[model samples]
Target: MSDKEELYCIPSRYRKTENLHIVFWLVKDLCWVMLWKPLGLIMIIPTLGAALLITWQTRAIKSELLHNVAVVFWITANAYWMLSEFYSTDDSLRYYAVIPFSLGIITIGYYYLGLFSKKVR
Candidate 1:
């Protein structure tokens, strides 16, 4: 091939790059959600203690962590407004709290799942 033509040559269709991008992101999200919320919060202390056993474990200051932390706190605080419904029994207020809590959980899961794949490198 001439030098000019060589630059334009494309690779054969047989070669395909493996894409794990979506999968990695999903894993990060799952971890974040499962670790951040109250159910997950209960596990955090033990989780961190376990991490100390791994000398090579890398720590990343991911924005996702900050985001998840905010979400967890937000949901927890709103939970009072949630439970307050039981006193006077206003179902709507309690129902409203569910949305934020659910959203926070999903965000946490999505973001944290991405972290696992990142740390491997």
Candidate 2:
């Protein structure tokens, strides 16, 4: 990173929310692992909400925005996958998580393509 880029600072309040977001995501996944269907499903609300909030907070920086948007897609896919298994619908629905997973991949790919391109400014 350049000197200017290295100087970029994330506000403390936003950083706190980002950290909280991780906690919520972990709780959601843990509930899923323990097969606590009710709490696991409920946890999706806060987990996804936090991800959305983080994505919004980082909207000003292209790299951060792209990565955050990918995270939103990831949580969405994860939530859907978890719900599918919880409902015993995995046979027909789990694979659908690929949609959002692929979206996340595409977003990252777009970010990298722009970053690596040799186009003149």
**How does each model score on TM-score?**
0.33, 0.91
Question: Model 1: how far is 29 from its true place, Å?
Answer: 29
Shift of residue 39 alpha carbon in model 2, Å? 0.7
Off by more than 4 A, model 2: 1-5, 118-121
Output the TM-score of candidate 2.
Answer: 0.91
Per-residue lDDT of 18-106 in model 1, one digit per residue for the tens? 12322333443454444434433334333333323221122233553446454454445343442343244566665566666667666
Give the local distance difference test score of model 2.
0.93
lDDT string for model 2 (13-119, tens) is 99999999999999999999999999999999999998899899899999999999999999999999998898974488899999999999999999988887846
